[model samples]
Target chain A: MSPEAQEFLHTFVSESFYYWASVFMLLIHAGFLAYEGGASRVKNVLATMVKNLITLASVGLAFFFFGWWVYNAFPLFPMAGPILGPWTNPEASEAIKAAMPYVEGSYPWSSALGPNNADHMTGVFFFAFALFAMTTASIMSGALIERVKIGAYVFLSIILGGFTWLVAAAWGWNYFGWLFAKMGYHDFGCSGILHATAAFFTLGVLLNLGPRVGKYDPQGKPRQIMPHNLPLTMVGLLLIFIGFYAFLAACVIFLPGYEGETTIYGTPVTLASIGVSTTLALAAGLVGAYISAKADPFYTISGGLAGIISAAGGMDIYHPAVVMLIAFVGAFLMPKVAMFVERMGVDDAVGAIAVHGWCGVFGAVVVGVAAGGFPQGEGIPAINLGTQILGVVLFAGLLGFLPGYGCSWVMKRFDLLRVSPEEEVAGLDLADLGVPGYPEYATYEYVNEQLPVAQSSGSTKYAE
Target chain B: MQFSPLLAIFNPSPFQTHSEFLEVEGPFYTFAHQPGMIAFLLILCALGSIYFVYASFFIKGEQAGLKSPLALSLLLALGLGAVAERVYQQTLRQSDRPTSAVTRGVQMRSPQAPSPRLKPLALLGLVGGSAAASRRRRSSASRQRRIR
Candidate 1:
């Protein structure tokens, strides 16, 4: 094993981890499909499922191509240099091609692998971000579950997941992003970029699409749209929680490396910090949401997630006690805010507006004050509540909510947003699927065996 | 407006060289732009008061248990916020960060950066379009009732 083989091996393993994370994140999409399917009316389940599947296929492919490139390119393309600047950047581009990693003039993509100087984690790193992009799109899938057309929603998913979320990530989340470099804006994970942006975007779409036909009466009052299967929905959220952990874990650089002072404690970076804060936040969120909800299982689970969303921007540095405490606030706010949004006539079917969108804004904004006066890092500007709010505005309002609203307005104008009224009444699934998933669920044998008994009982009871 | 003033409050600064974007010096540091948990609590208290005062005008008939869907959604929102933040922190999520010590011009690279040509979108449009291309699920009873 030569030293060169070691570097190549590292790149392979890291890239593999990156791709596999997507495999794990896939469970989240699957869970959302099931969860949304269950939440929908019986007539609309399959249609909802199709919406989920479409988001996955479309968002994945979109990100794989230019989606990933844009993230890489935007970080410093014009700022860093020129056309091939991103491609040739000594820092961020492909290390193998530049360095001639293995044999000179003979490599995978080209004759030489780029520069050999980098630690070799860029591809895996981008893949991780791409996965986040997919989740952002997937978030919209859940909110617009019952009404959005598969085609229309799929188109929307590509825009939200592939383009919108990436732009936010570049602006707020990326270290080299102008936002991070200049604004001192910080989002440890996507409080704004992923969650908030998706939430607002969903709100935008819902505004134009309107609720499922009967969601509101002619009187403008909202109705109770129960999940067709509460237990299944619960199960779906549990899967989301489990997979969400992966989504969160993928946001930080976790691979082992040596920073001076050798000892883990002394090293500026440690997975332990993330681990501790995450735990504290989860516990706090769980308790806070559960306490408020009186133990409603659905809210309990979703609140737990919201807690994390609201505090995600600086989870990496908050004290454990503070982390738990803030998480409680996160949990406390998520529901209250969402309910308020709903009351305002903005229907977010799965609370996407509240959980991801509003909460994301809150979380991003929270960072400005939470770490106030602290050095944002050299050359990264000073912290300001106003700036943080602006970041939230840039991401949630401008890039996310406003644009989302604008898109919906346009979509509505073009008649490309949702199904017609008749279809909504019949149920999108029934119109889409040739047959309903359930026919009272009587097995062929059971129906034969039980039908006669039922008939006999009816006759006897009536006769008596 | 200055971006970091507010942002700094929430995600204030830490020590890092121009080169080391990926390093964190300590446990999660609370920022200065916004109130810490204590201030947030005060705000919540204010909000609670407002909520209570608003409800004071409501008749007794309006008070209800946790069964309403709106109530349930509110509850879910809170929980999901916590969970999303927690999940992000707990996972070993990372992006590429060049080391501070590595002299100028030394950074990692990736395999052919993902290309954004028409191919990827075509695939998504094709497969995802199938979702649109899919057969609409129908209910037998509705179909039968219509036929009758």
Candidate 2:
């Protein structure tokens, strides 16, 4: 093929690959909606589902306006004058500068944001990254279900999805990012950047938001708050498992002239490797959860996600057996972690902190242990253990926890974080949205009767 | 006068002439070059600020003192006004140029190029009009309750 023909083919294939990956990633949102909706009591289901929808819209718009620009502009942030300033690989930095050329391409007003004949990749690539942003926001949403004020949640979502995670990506995930260039950080599957960051962010919000009203007894002992529909939650997890494949696929790059695929770090990898490891990780996770959590359906399904996340950091590097072993151990430890978190007086409704946060950290550590001394890229330092630990602390504590905690703390001070106690007991859908998720059911009538007369005034109309 | 970063945000497009802008190739070429884009963004910022205030305060029934929202809205409006004034000046300058320059600018844009004023105006109408309509509904409902 001619050079031009090869370039065209590459652009077309790359565009189609990301576009399809984005389309399939929609299933992750669908899964989150189903999962959170089923986890909430009947009254809060619509409220739970609406938050997921808002996550998609808010993050999408935010990413379009500024999030993409942040990723492009801040890869070597705090060093303004020369692109090759301190702690950066000059050659790799130059290559990335040529590839991104953010000033010309990434601004909201840039022609690349529109239908420019000169650019074919920006829009689809932006969509894929935006979906990742939405996924991060959705991961936080499940942990705050039932009692969080919608407006407060939306504010936090934009901060996390649009701003914070992008900052983390600019630091750790980019080819010439300071973390990779200076510390040889590698997280091919975004285990630290996306999962751990969002999970830790959720932990911050949960600390301020507190447990649901009835989550604990007067004795301070935790009680079981059964999901409205366990089966629906399980199905949601299954869809998420499917969507995760696309998520992993988006992390790989298909260079135009190169014969094989590469991880985001430009290291050689294969789709077959990703597929085999992911499948085995899922099976191992399920078995581990089954044995550890005593066949609890919720924990078992959750283990599947924990499994992928625990092994995600090394998906491009780890052998199938290693992946399986790591995933199994992560899943086995997830319930214990959740119990530990709960013992510390934090109530995570969906084990999000455990599944995403704990497993994400676990995955990153495993990679450091397993792939230590591996070459990252030209002019970048080799991967090592200390940097991986630093990534966890940076991603989880500085980037994730501080912003999450500070923002929620402010919201809490203003009484904007959680719904009023009255509203929480009356159900968020009835109190806030003024519609029940299941108005046709007799349970609606029962709930209406259960409410005090003052709280029931406007809600009775729903029954009528 | 010292340059204000806030002022820079309102004047996003740097190109001064249609000919100068057309030298750049891409889709949405005209859209980005047009001064109206600045007004559109300023208006978006204004509306977003207003909505955030409304959602955070009014919807939650918290007493938000009028000052914060009022000041923010005023600042955003000033930004929009500046953009509009600049666009008006640019339009006047462009009218003095040769007709061929104008024709070339038009030709450079896609066939579906939107009128420069349409987006900001439409967005203003949608958000402001919806808020007014909802307030009217609430008032009528309260009036009915008093009557009953």
Candidate 3:
């Protein structure tokens, strides 16, 4: 091919790849919708679906306005001084300069954030990151479903997605992030910055929201709250499994250099490694979860997720055996963690906390041990047990759990954290939306009667 | 590239009593063959096994003593995170090269693009409107029930 043709082709391919990555990330949301809907009771399915849809819309717009800017701008934020400066390379220095959120080249007001003759990839890149931000919000959404107020949900979603998650990305995921530059923090696939952040955020919300009605008996023995449609939930998980291909691919930083694709931290890796580690981890997780939970399908699918998360931090560097073994351990531990949390009275409707939170922390630890002493970035220290552990604790405890807890606590104080008990027993659909997801399958009286405390007598009278 | 763990299964010197497994290829066997990684995996396994056994057999459910320990552990984690972040900031400051936190934050807020403020307003409106409608519906339903 001619030189001009080759350049055009490269641009076309790069833009196309990013666009597709964003599209595939949408599948993650579809999966969450299906996953949450199936997990919800027949009455709350529509409500659950609405929450998922709103998160995409809210987080999408918010990300466009401020989220992307936050990621670029805050890499060395909440700290003083130039990071990795004294740069002789013009390109490198310019790239760093443009990262500031309010800068002319990168932020919302900048033409760079939009489609321009000079740039074709910026918008596409933003789309992918926006989707990631939305995904983090959706993870928290699932755990708080069926009980949370819409106002509270939307408020928290924006805080987590558009603000907190972006901030965490700035601190940890950014190449120039102080965590990477100074502390040698490494999270190849956002296991800590994204998944664990969301997981801990969800955990905090669950603590304040309280358990679903009849989740436990008077004796405190947990009762089973099975998914309304296990098949749908499984299918949703399958969609997520498919979407993960794009999610994992998006983590690669493809630049014009001797090495084409590298991690955000500038670490070179083969796509083959990611593929091998992810699949083996998934397989191991499935087996571990299946065996641990005595072959329950819900836990089995959850195990698959745990598997992916368990090895996510080291996917680029880990051997397949390491991936499998890590995932297996994570999968096995997740169910026990879930049961333990349930006993503690934090009723996570799905195993969101176990699969995302515990597994995320586990995955980062895998990287610390397995890939410890490996260089994470230029001029930074090697990955180590202390750094990895510190990242997990900070992301999961301070950045993740603290904000989630504080937000939900305020919402709870104002009675915005949960639906009224009457709404809970009658179902969110009848109470909130005045419409049932399935009128044919609706059994209002039976649902109300099963409640430990009957707040409403024969849920009746509705407005058009 | 066609990747496989065949080396793990088909070692050339199978007859040797003390053959090194470090020569294997593929993503799985290559890393597992490393001594440090092997030691890491073994330690993790041992710890995992003990924890699993203890959790399953001894700590059944609703133990009152668990709360204090969990709280204490979480507090320690928070303190450690705070310290680490502070240390990281210190390192960034003491370095010969410096990154400007103030300029970055300022530049981040003042994008060169024509970013309209209407989008955020619209988002707030959508969420606020839906919430109000739901609140009205619930109050109206309750009133209707009371009248009946």
Question: At residue A158, what lDDT does model 2 achieve?
Answer: 94
Query: What are the Cα lDDT values of the candidates?
Result: 0.60, 0.74, 0.71
- How far off is residue A424 in model 3, in Å? 1.5
TM-score of each: 0.68, 0.71, 0.73
Candidate 1 TM-score over all chains jointly: 0.68
Q: Which is the leading candidate under lDDT? A: 2
Tens digit of per-residue lDDT, candidate 3, span B30-144: 2443455456555654554464456455432231112233543454366457445544543443342222432211222222222322322332243334334434655687699
Candidate 1's C-alpha runs over 4 A off are A1-13, A76-123, A254-268, A440-464, B1-148
Ranking by TM-score: 3, 2, 1
Quick one: best DockQ, which candidate? 1
Give the poorly placed runs of model 3, Cα more than 4 Å off.
A80-103, A256-258, A442-464, B1-148
On TM-score, the stronger of 1 and 3 is 3
State which candidate has the highest TM-score: 3
Residue A25, model 2: Cα distance from true site in angstroms: 0.8
Q: Indicate the worst ten consecutive residues by lDDT in candidate 3 chain A.
A: A81-90
Residue B71 shift from truth in candidate 1, angstroms = 16
After superposing candidate 2, which stretches have Cα over 4 Å from the reference? A1-6, A79-100, A444-464, B1-148
lDDT of 2 by residue, A1-464 (tens): 99898789888998899999999999999999999999999989999999989999999999988888777766676533233222334346454555456534667887887887678888888889999999999999999999999999999999999989888888889875778777778798988999999999999999999999999999997787889998999999999999999999888888556667777777666777788878977876775565455556888899999989988887886655556666876786676577667766788999899899999988886676545445555566656656787888999998899999999999999999999999999899998899989877768546556445535575665445
